[model samples]
Target chain A: MTSYHSINFAQKISKLDELWSPRVISEMNEYQFKAVRIQGDFIWHDHPETDEAFIVLQGRLRIDFRDGAVLIEAGEMFVVPKGVEHKPFAEEEVHLLLIEPRGTLNTGHAGGSRTKPNDLWL
Target chain B: MTSYHSINFAQKISKLDELWSPRVISEMNEYQFKAVRIQGDFIWHDHPETDEAFIVLQGRLRIDFRDGAVLIEAGEMFVVPKGVEHKPFAEEEVHLLLIEPRGTLNTGHAGGSRTKPNDLWL
Candidate 1:
């Protein structure tokens, strides 16, 4: 029988031990849904190939752009357009659901030590 | 300056007066994130061209397939594969976030009176 399980955001997020590291939870077409826990500031980066969506599951998220910043609280979301430089910061540990295409990196084109391997399932 | 506003799911869902009708909130690439309020049973349909993802923001949801059913509660999500017939039912009113490609109809190929206009923004 095909698995009819649902992906619980909080449940999957609880299993994530590393901050800034997102693990794939599900996929739709070529897009992927990832669960991640983040706190503090992230590196500035830009996905030249695809847009990135951030859905806040718990706590607040702030994405700083070149011109302004967006504050995303629980039950809120923001989408960063492709080729826009952004740096994400969280005051507290924030659980997030990131939706983007497969092979999209956490650090975008700003490859650094913070870059985690893609397609790591939770 | 570019708009730096975030989309609040609950705030958007509250503006919806019609049940089972989804309104576009934001877009990431070719995909759109829609907020909707739903209750009762939906028509059995399947998207042949792409998959559909449903993220429950409040209440419980049950998606019935030919062989099995998947129950998704608040903070949970499920992606119905392309060409898989499924019907969604909710015991009470449910706040939902739907992610699908642009121009996707709520009623898929089983279009009928239940098919609402696509791309209606909130």
Candidate 2:
């Protein structure tokens, strides 16, 4: 097993160049912690079995549900429930820490066009 | 089921007074997010089954393992693996976000004297 030192999220986020691509930073049991930079619109998708947690580290983000939307700013967090379809959008670039089960896809149900296959650790 | 709006971790943490007692802020699937203010020395303990994640939002924290210790600073995180006997100590007051299952107790095996039975939601 790989032992870990304490990790700095800000320092790791600074190293990322691609938007919407999530890099695994740490893991707890079966779950993985990911950091992602996103802007504009992301495809509408939902995980059928696992609930996804989104924590806004910097900037602003919006998760639009079918009937309404929730806006999350820095220092806030929101959990998108399982089987609930939602689209994530950011007018400006937003940094996010995502929590989900290991091997879970970013695009969820909708893939192909925007599916990012590679998962990196920082 | 209770639907959640985006939550601010900073604002919620600001309202805490008692140190070492954890408050539940959010939940995703079977897991829950908790905010805890800790200082000085904590009891040595270990969860027999679950892994615990510690994310330092402010100040500094150190987790002393049997062999070595991990020093976590602001914007940093560390995961204490299952069944590892560890002691958490912070020279200064540290703001922490802890992730675990819904009914996890702060003191895993060692309790009684330093056990906090009440769990609050902020």
Candidate 3:
């Protein structure tokens, strides 16, 4: 049987409304993951040197790239490897947790309407 | 303020026993993390090609090394980089979550008395 403080990703998603914002859930080593609610369009950005993992806890999100795009729904995850320019957006509000090294930038290169400040705890 | 589906590390530790064994709490990407309860004396081993993170959820655990030993307690985390020979043990029961790439070995260099099989969910 599975046991250990089970983090209810669904339960958390029901409690917020906003876009491109995240909340810290827990920390391991020097890295911690933040769950955020996102909607509409996020700014174009990329993390030049770190790989990040995004897990869809609810709704849907699409990542736009220079070459193509990919859509992700709840119960799915995508790893945006470092140095890849990508933009994330949604038709409706979506819930997600972003996993990466501590101090990772929310925006990669084009930091204009959506680059979030570092260490904003949800 | 902060809110999200909070996974209680302390609450999880109160529910299990045994050594080098783990329990799954969540899944992301193709990887999942399992929290394990461990105790006295494990065999020396090494993971040749993956970085593993160990977060001490409760009690105290010590990682034995070829030249030194590091003690980690609750609220502490240690990363054992790939290809390092090490052993983990505790004076009493210690709770932890081992994070690494999916399919990484529990026992790396030498697999004898303490190498755990892959995918044993707690």
Give per-residue CA lDDT, model 3, range B5-119, as digits (tens): 3244445555556567666655544455667888888888888876677767678888887877787776455677678787888999888867766677677767676666777
Model 1 lDDT tens row, B1-122 = 56689989989988999999999999999999999999999999999999999999999999999889999999999999999999999999999999999999999999999999999999
Compute DockQ for each candidate against the true complex: 0.75, 0.57, 0.06
- Against the reference, the lDDT scores of all candidates come to 0.94, 0.89, 0.69
Give the lowest summed-lDDT range of ten residues in model 2 chain A.
A1-10
lDDT of 1 by residue, A1-122 (tens): 55599988878998999899999999999999999999999999999999999999999999999998999999999999999999999999899999999999999989989999999999
Put down candidate 3 lDDT per residue, A16-119, tens digits, no spaces: 46567666665544566677888888877778877777767678888887777777776445677678787888899888877776777777667676666767
TM-score comparison, 1 vs 3, better candidate: 1
Question: Which numbered prediction scores highest in lDDT against the true structure?
Answer: 1
Name every residue pair that clashes in candidate 3: A45-A108, A46-A108, B23-B122, B46-B108, B46-B109
Ranking by TM-score: 1, 2, 3
Cα lDDT for residue A61, model 3? 80
In DockQ, how does model 1 score against the reference complex?
A: 0.75
On DockQ, the candidate that comes out on top is: 1
CA lDDT for candidate 3 = 0.69
Q: Could you list the chain B TM-scores for each candidate?
A: 0.97, 0.93, 0.82
lDDT (C-alpha) at residue A19 in model 3: 62
What is the lDDT, from 0 to 100, of the residue A105 in candidate 1? 93
lDDT of 2 by residue, B61-104 (tens): 99998888999998889999999999999999999999998778
Residue runs of model 1 more than 4 Å from their true location after superposition: A1-3, B1-3
Note the chain A TM-score of all models in turn. 0.97, 0.93, 0.84
Better of 2 and 3 by TM-score: 2
**Relative to the unseen true structure, what is the C-alpha lDDT of residue A113 in candidate 3, on a scale of 0 to 100?**
66
